[model samples]
Target: MTEESSDFKFNYFFGLVNLVAVFLIVWFLWYIFMNPNTVMKLYTPMYGFSLIVVFLSGIILMAKVLKWPAWYNRLFQKDKPITKGILLTIIAFLLMIGLNYIVFWGFIGKFGIAYFSPDSIVASGGIGAEPFVARENASTAIVYFFTAFLWMALFWDLGFGRWPWQNDTYGVQAWSKLFAILFFVVLFYILLFHSHVCYLFYPAQDKAAVTPWWEELAGTGSAFFSLGLILCTLVWIVFSDLLWEGKPWNRYEVDGESTFGKGFVVFFSTLTFGIILIFILLMIFNYVWMEPFVGGQYTDGPDWRYIHAGEIAGFFILAAFIWKNYFNNFPNLDSLWLRALIRSIIAVVLGLLIYWFYYSPLATFFLAKVEGFAQPGDTPLVWALLFLSIILVQSEFFDGWPLKRKK
Candidate 1:
């Protein structure tokens, strides 16, 4: 084989090995910190997972969206990839911890809203006094907000591609984009999830927030509808970028640059595609499991079904990322559409494999999860997102170290 071919095989082999290594590392951490059977179970899967996702989202904003690390890269210009990655990871974790605990739970919860503080929620009486219930509820609201934050971040990156700030200095650009993203995150949270979250507690805080408007259509007031849609939206967003290479979306760019029109097009199209995906996945779920009925819980429930669809989408997101990073996004066909189609198929197949493995008997034993689908208090997202976080950290923070070729 040629030198180029030999190197490709070597890189591919190591990349796959690294993928397994990263996952084992993450799994070890998860079992220790977030495992259900563990004494320090921290919180319910949802609560712990939400906090993790929020931290991961913050890292994505700093590392990828705002590209803040690029600015810092100059300062650490002489550092190796591993050193830079370690330092950046440490700083980012500390920053997120402060923001999550000190700012939100500490200051905001103390001086502003009661819901931000689990203690305050617990102290308020009623359902809040219930064990673990208050923290779950608090996390539910927090995750909803950050979920919107993540969607906006991905959307902005995919659609806008740094427009308006593309020419600005790193400091100006990063902070400006940060503010812009936060503005939308808060706006979307209020319009979409705040009402549902307010109603999550007993004697719903109707005065604090409005009733969910999508309750009738979505079969419940739960924000999982929003979460489902957002997660599905994310699948398409990442798929477009990685699998399709931004085919149709990039085609809409004006003068070879991202414009308002292009961004808006990507925004609506992906969401529309997301809705379709939810429909299709739900239909598929019906054949595999019992039909969802009203007032049903878990597997036969509508609310969980919505979020479950998103959970499946999360797998696709992870698979796409893995494919792009590890396997060189294989099947380098000549036809663009054909290549995209094959890549899509590969991603979906791989996603389904992950879905199976996650819920498998072996996985159930290790994860401390009860055997069966849609068990109460069990979500694959925690695992999926955890895995995705590690992948992102490897690629973005570590610059694919050990696998990345140097200039």
Candidate 2:
């Protein structure tokens, strides 16, 4: 086979495998039904050892099995461009996120005609529970998990894009696609768990109870400190030389670099703190914590509370740290900064456009009807970052993040 064709075969092999796994999961769910303990056993780690080996081995097969040596290389390689990967990833994310909202609205509203029903979603009855958020843990899992799967197919294209059926290469090297997809599948749930999303309303009830999974897995209070250790190790590994002038300890994006330092710190700080805070918030606010469930075995939430953001949360934290170490610091905005700024702008515009086109209708249908749900601050910062993404994309990819740049 030609090189391109060979690559295509490699890419799709895993995609098919992942699809089969998903299908099996659905069929299993359809057959035996929603056994919380069974799913928990599949996901949970024991005695600080993780089931990551199982899940990652199963889901993470696309990269190694495909023999794509370029997977990790694309991220840290000194020569290969990372911007194209970023653009594709962001675009893919926007599509994924937008679709999730659409699908969610569809099931909840049953098209534009109906409203959310907990009974339908949780299989208990209807959506009118007072503390909706507490009662709908399963709802969040089902909606966001599958929405993320749709996104995974895009990333799989890279790793297995060279697979037999629809082999193609666009931006990233074919080897790295699987990691890209895996990251989002994990990340979306993390975002929702923290935000306490569309499950029901705030202060949920009746769903189920959680145990102390994270507090147990994290080995108690050392989550952040251990993250600090990982950050230090990566910093020293990448920029061990004295010539490394960038702030190895900081977090933020640099031009033509992975923004590892900033990203990792963001990963751990924001990501870890997001989960940690969720626990704290739920415990302190009795009304909010158990709002979804009516009242279960434990008045306090269960240990499963921390799974979404647990082990790999620090990897993202490590990623940002690495980015910073490589790029050093932000540019003066002369050659690079402008492009970075423009890329951010484009992302916002594209994101907003997608939101307007796809997500808006869904939101209007199901979510819009609910008042007091909108939290309206930070419009400027969010949009400004969007503009910054535009610039970053230009700086990284087309030599300038601009409207006029080559598509």
Q: Pick the candidate with the highest TM-score.
A: 1
Deviation in Å, model 1, residue 156 alpha carbon: 0.3
Worst 10 residues of 2 by lDDT: 43-52
Displacement of residue 373 (Cα, Å) in model 2 is: 19
The regions of model 1 sitting more than 4 angstroms off are: 1-10
lDDT of each: 0.82, 0.32
> Which parts of model 2 have CA positions greater than 4 angstroms off?
1-98, 101-176, 179-381, 401-407
lDDT of 1 by residue, 202-257 (tens): 88999999889988888888888899989999999999988887788887776777
lDDT of 2 by residue, 1-407 (tens): 12222222223344345434433443343223222234432211110011111222222232233322244345655233455445443543454334333443345434421223333443334444433432233333343344344324422332223333223452333335455555766674344232233323333332431322333443332122222232223222222111123233232434423343544453454334444544443344444454323222222323222221221222322223222222222232444435334433433343344334223444333222122212221011112122223333333333221212222
